[model samples]
Target: MQPTILITGATGGIGIALARLLKDHAQLVLLGRNPQKLTSLQTEFPEARTEALPLTDAQAVQALIETLPALDAVVHCAGEVVLSSIQDSQLEDWESMYQSNVLTALVLTQQALPQLRASRGKVVFVNSGAGLRASPGWGGYAASKFALKALADALRQEEPLISVTTVYPGRTATDMQKQVRDMEHAEYQPEKYVRAEDVAQAIKTVLDMQRPSVIEELSIRPG
Candidate 1:
């Protein structure tokens, strides 16, 4: 049987690209919030199973993971990037960013630990380059990603059998960028951004690593 990979934020962006790329390699268990998008992807990946839920909801996230039998991998691709200066960043916006980038990953990882332990599975975090250091306007988004990186590192130490990989991707051509550019008046040109498919391919390579080998961290930036 093909190994199963549970992918969060499967509606679009790198998540959608990864699902399409890995469809042949793994049985995909897609998770997302939008019913229409979930149904659409389910039709596209007819062989894969799907769960539609807002992952920030702790109970919903836990229940969704509990329903899975055994997973070979879990990819936390669900995240949000909000660019606001520290002084102007609203508390609510920071919380929202944390919910999307940090809490969602935490909730899913915590619940998926048992199945991952059972199979010695992999946990791949789709982090951001902003995670590594501070950027002026990236206070909220960067902070959340930094927290995610710390969590992934700690988890790797605790669960040596279950490999952990964190991917730091630079600006990507996705709806998330569109929202930022549109709402914040930032000049985010999608044409200049990295192709989502590239990130998906990188993730596939990480997943195909041999046993006893782990890609602890990887960074992908567009030239």
Candidate 2:
């Protein structure tokens, strides 16, 4: 039997690409918010299951994971990036990032722990380079990314049996980039953008590795 993989934020961008990349081999389940997007993706891969739910809803997140039959891996790619200077950053924006990036990942991890342990599965985090460094006007996004990275690091240390891999993908070509460009005045030119499929392939490679082998951190930046 093919191993089952659970993915969050699977309706778009990196998540969507990863889903498609893995669909040929794995039993894939995707979680997202848009019904139309989920419907469209499900049509493309009828073998994959779609769960339309916001990550912020704890009850919904818990229910979704608890009902899953089994899982061999989980890729968390559901997140938002809102940029603002530290001085001008609203509490609301910071809260939004925390809820979407930090809390949601934690909730999902907690909910999936049982299934993961049952399979001795892997947990892959779609983190950013911002998670590793700081820059002016990157306070909000950077802080959230750092927290997310820390969570994966801590998990890896505590659960050595379950591979915890964090992939820092630099400025991927996606709608998120457009949002960041508009909100932060940061022009993410295509010349510098890493194709989402490249990141997807990296993930598939990591998953294909032997159980004893582990990739703790992977950084993919455009050359």
Candidate 3:
């Protein structure tokens, strides 16, 4: 049987690219926050399941997982980014960053652990390059990503049955990247960055890897 994969942030650039690539290969369970986008995805991937779930809501995520009989993979593509310096950043800024970038991944993964262990599934976190280092104006965002990396690392150690991989992609040409450029007061050049499809292809590689050798981490950058 084809693997049953759950992809969060299914409406985002990388998520959409990945879903398009895997539509014929796997049973997709696309989860996103925007109801309208989820509707569009339902039309787009008629055979795939779609859910408009708030991943941060532990109760909601648990309730959703209760419906799934088998899940082979869970790819976390949902996240947010905000550029702020130490002096200008507000407390809520950090809180929101953690909530979106870190908590959602944690809550969803925690709720789905039982099935993952049963299926010996894969967990992929679509992390950012900022996760490895903190730029001047990117401290808050980086901190949250760093925390996400920590979560992935601990999961890798704790859940030996399930392979955990963190993918760090450099600036990609997406709407989010455009917003990031606008924040930096720079030009929005989609052509200069990595394509979302490339990232998706790399993720497919991770999910397809066979036994005895798991991809613990992967880093991708623009050419």
The best candidate in terms of lDDT: 3
Task: Tell me the TM-score of model 2.
Answer: 0.95
Report the candidate with higher TM-score, 1 versus 3.
3
Q: Per-candidate RMSD vs. true structure? A: 1.4, 1.4, 0.7
**How well is each residue in 35-104 modelled by candidate 3, as lDDT tens digits?**
9999999999999999998888999999988898899999999988889889999989899989999999
Q: Lowest summed lDDT over 10 consecutive residues: which window, candidate 2? A: 183-192
Order candidates by TM-score, high to low: 3, 2, 1
How close is every model to the real structure, measured as TM-score?
0.95, 0.95, 0.98
Q: Which candidate model has the greater lDDT, 2 or 3?
A: 3
lDDT of 2 by residue, 1-223 (tens): 9999988889898999999899889999988878998899889889888988767677887788777788899999998888878998898998988888888888888778888988999999999999999788889889999999999999998886689999999989998888988876667687688999999999998888887898889999988
Number of the top-ranking candidate, with TM-score as the measure = 3
lDDT of 2 at 28: 94
lDDT values of the candidates? 0.89, 0.88, 0.95
Clashes counted in candidate 1 amount to 0
What would you estimate as the lDDT of candidate 3? 0.95
Task: For candidate 1, write residues 1-223 as lDDT tens digits.
Answer: 8898999989899999999999998889998888999999988999998888777677887787777777889999988777789889899989998998988888888888888999999999999888998878888888999999999999999997799999999889999879878767878788899899999999999999988888999999989
What's the lDDT of the predicted structure labeled candidate 1? 0.89
